[model samples]
Each structure stands twice: as C-alpha cells, then as structure tokens.
Target: MIEIKNLCHSLGGKLILNDINLTLPEGSIMGLVGINGAGKTTLLRLISGVYSADEGEIFCDGLPIGDEKARERLFFLPDDPYFTGHTTGKALFELYRVFYPDIDRKVFLEYMSEFKLDEKKPIRNFSKGMRRQLYIALALSVKPKYLLLDEAFDGLDPLARLSFKRAINQAAEEYGTTVIISSHSLRELEDFCDSYALIDKMTIASSGDIAERVNRYCKFQLAFFEDFSEQIFFGLPVISLEKTGRFARIVLEGKEDDMKKALEKLSPAIVEQMPMDFEEMFIREVEGRGYKV
Candidate 1:
C-alpha cells in the first residue's frame, strides 16, 4: 500500500497542494479527477518522487517514497514522457532496462507487435498516439509493483483506448500492479477504475469507491397527468430538480428502492428512474463544494 500524510507542495512561491492525505492499496486501479489546473498532475508527481513534498511524507509499502528500494518498485510516466531525438523504440527499451534490470524484452516485443509498432524505427517519427502506445508497452515490461500515468488516454482513438484499458487490466490482474491514472475522461475512468480521488481547492477533496459514490443518489423522471408543485419533493432529500410542464426530473439522495417507494406515494402517471453515471456524480460533487466546472 501507498500512504501519503499531510503532503504539501509549492512551485515559484505559489502553493500547488496543501495538507493532502491519501491511502492507495496494492493491485487496484485509481482514477484521479479534477478540473484543469487543479493540481492532479502535481499530486501524482509528488507520489512518484519527481517533486519533493514541502511538508509531511509519502510511504510506499513501508519505505519513504524517495528511497531507492521504494522507487524501484514503482514507475512514473509523465504527461509528456521524454525521448531523445532520433531515439528508436529499441533504444528506449534499452534505456529503461538500465533502470529496470528485469525488464521483460519478450513482453516488450509482444506489445510492440500487438500495437503494430516497429522497434527499429525512431520514436521521433512516431505519431503522438504511437508514442503513447510505446511508452505503455515499456511500462508493462518494467512490471513495477506500482505504476503512475498522467493524462494516460490523451492521444488515442476509441480502438486504442479500448486496447490500453485491456492492457492496464491485464497488468493489474496478472502482476498485482497498483496503477494510478490521471485523466479528464470520467466515462473512461468509470469503465475500469475501482475507486477515485477528486482534487479541489489545492487538496484532495474526496475519495472513495466509485460505485458506492455514484449510486448514493438516485435520479428519476416523473410525468403526472395532473399538475403538481415542485415543492412536493422539497421535504425529501432532493439534490436537484428540473421540470417541464407536468414532466419533472429529480435527483434524490437515497437508495433506489426507498426513493422509488417514496416517489410512488405521489401517484404520478409515469415514473421512470434514470441511471446516474460517474460524470454526473462528479459535477454535482464539485458544484456542491462551490467549485464551478
């Protein structure tokens, strides 16, 4: 497990993150979500030891995050990973092998083939998406206990995104790799992440199981033959409500069964429940905290 306690950071005399605490377990994929410039990448960099914390500390397993042994068990892939000019994919692999002596050349070759990349070709000539794929393959070959990826799905088509997700899952299941991926795509994160952390106000505002958080509030669409006042649902734990004539869509905070039973008491002509996904939950959460998206 990774433990962060009272972590703080600053750059150019401006505070980026403050008093942040987090616990990430082994073998689970976590999604880091936030608005642009919310310090999501900065937090990831701190955990990876690229930027030292100005206060508190980070522990990987049991060692301090900056320790060589602790660092050896993790790999950090930045938003823009570096590759020298005219560097071939094979040369990249060789360079990585220096840091990760156990780098699996066979697995690397297999991934290159699967992604239809030529190892002999210079990475400078590769497209943005192609370079992303190559780096992902290298990360897998390193087989670290923990993996950190920033903007992991930036330059890819739908097919490539699917492939990347599959590869990440495979790594977690097969090698117990603990992965933390930062992305703006909530839909993509919802597809695979077991949990999420939301960054706001220069700190980790919230974090929890993805399913439980999204399911806490139930949404419903209601249509009544007779008119009804919007005040009817005021007594209930309504998060948000919108109405059009006799048709009203409401989001209430409660379990599905209980909320449905409560809405049924109103005896509406039509009552249909709508599923709330991660994106909606995120928007509501941040808005509740007075952060405009």
Candidate 2:
C-alpha cells in the first residue's frame, strides 16, 4: 500500500501540491486526472520520489519514500523517458537490471517480441509508439509492486493500446501490481481503472470508486405531453437542466428507482434514464469544484 500524508511541494517558490493526502491500496489501478498544468505530473513525481515533497511524508508498505527497499518495489515511467541516442533496447534493459535485480529478462524478451521491436536498434531511432512499447516492456520486466505511469498511452495506435491494456491488467492480476496512471485519455482510463483521484486547486479535490460515483447520480431525458417550462422541475434536486423545444435533459441527484419515482410524479409523455460513463461523471465532479472544463 502507498500512503501519502499531508504532502506539500513547490517549484521556484510557487506551490504545486499543498497538504495533499491519498491512500492507494495494493493490486488496484488508480487514475489521476486534471486539466493541463493542474500538477498531475508533479503529484506523480512526488509519489515516485523524482521530486521530494517539501513537507509531510510518503510511504510504501511501511517504508519511507526514497528508501532503497521502498524504491526497489516501485517504478516510475515519465511521459518522455530519457534514453541516449546510441542506447539499444537490450542495453536499456541491462542498465535497469543493475537497479532492479529481480528483472525477468525472459519476460522482457517476450514483450519485445510481442511488440515486434528490434532490440538491436537504438531507442532513439524508434518511432514514438515504438519507444512507448520499449518502456512498457521494461516496466513489465521489473514487475514492481507499484507502477507509476504518466501519459501512458500518448502515441500508441488502437491495437497497441489494447495490447498495453492487456499487459497491464495481466500484471495487476498476476503480480498484484499497484498502478497509478496519469493520462489525458479518460475513456481509456475508464475502461481499466477501478478508482480515481482528481487533482484540482493544488490538492486532491475528489477521489473515490469510479462505479459508485457514476451510479450516485443519473441523467434523465424527458418529453412532456403538454407545454412545460424550467419551473416544472423547480423543486426537484436537479444538478443541471437543458431544454430543446418540449424536450428536456436533466441530471438529477438520486438512485435510478428514486429518480424514476420522482419523475413519475410529473406526468411526461416519454422519460428515459441515460447512462453516464466515467468521463462524464469526472467532468461533472471537477466542474462542481469550479474547474471550467
């Protein structure tokens, strides 16, 4: 497990993260989200010990951050991983093995073959997606207890995305790899991540199980037989309402059955509950926190 307590950080005298606290359990995949410049990268860096926090503490399985023992159990993959122009895939793997002595070279070779990558070729000569595949292979080889990925799926094609997702899920299931991924691809995150931590206002503004949060509220599309105005839903607990002629779409705060009963109280020609995926739920949540997007 990873525990962050009252964590604070700043860069060049400007605060990035402030008094933030989070707990990520073992074998869980967590999605970290926010708008650009919301300090998503900063938070991940702090957790991975790339940048030490200015205050508070972070621990992994009871060991403090940066401890050699704790460090050995985790891997941090930045958005743009650094590699020299002449660094081949095999050389990179060897160098990583020096630090991660438990790295499985067989698994690494399998992944390299699965991705159809040429290990003899320098990483600098690989395409963007190819480079991502190389790093992913490296990550899987280490098989760390905690894997922190930043912009994990930036340049992969659709098929590569599926492969990466499969590999990640397999690792999580087999090795109990706890992953905290920061990405702009919310839909991709929605597909695999069971929980989420949303960054806003220099702190963790919201965090919870994704499914529970999405099901907490629902959207209903209603069409009234007679003429109806916005005043018709005046007393109801509506988070948002939009109108188009006699048709209306409203997001109400309640369970499906409860919302249905409430809507039934007002006779409508047609009413259907709409489904909200994780992305929509996240948008509403962050918007509630005064985030423009």
Instruction: State which candidate has the highest TM-score.
Output: 2
**Per-candidate RMSD vs. true structure?**
1.4, 1.3
| Model 1 lDDT tens row, 1-293 | 99999998998999999899999999889999998999999998999999999999999999999899999999988888888898999999989999899999999999999899999999999999999999999999999899999999999778889989999999999999999999989999999999999999999999989999999988999999978899888689887788999999888888999999999999999889999999988987877788754
* Segments in model 1 whose C-alpha atoms lie over 4 Å from true places: 226-228
Q: What TM-score would each prediction reach against the true structure?
A: 0.96, 0.96
Against the unseen true structure, what C-alpha lDDT does each candidate score?
0.92, 0.92
At residue 44, what lDDT does model 1 achieve?
89
Model 2: colliding residue pairs: none
Error of 2 at 281 (Å): 0.3
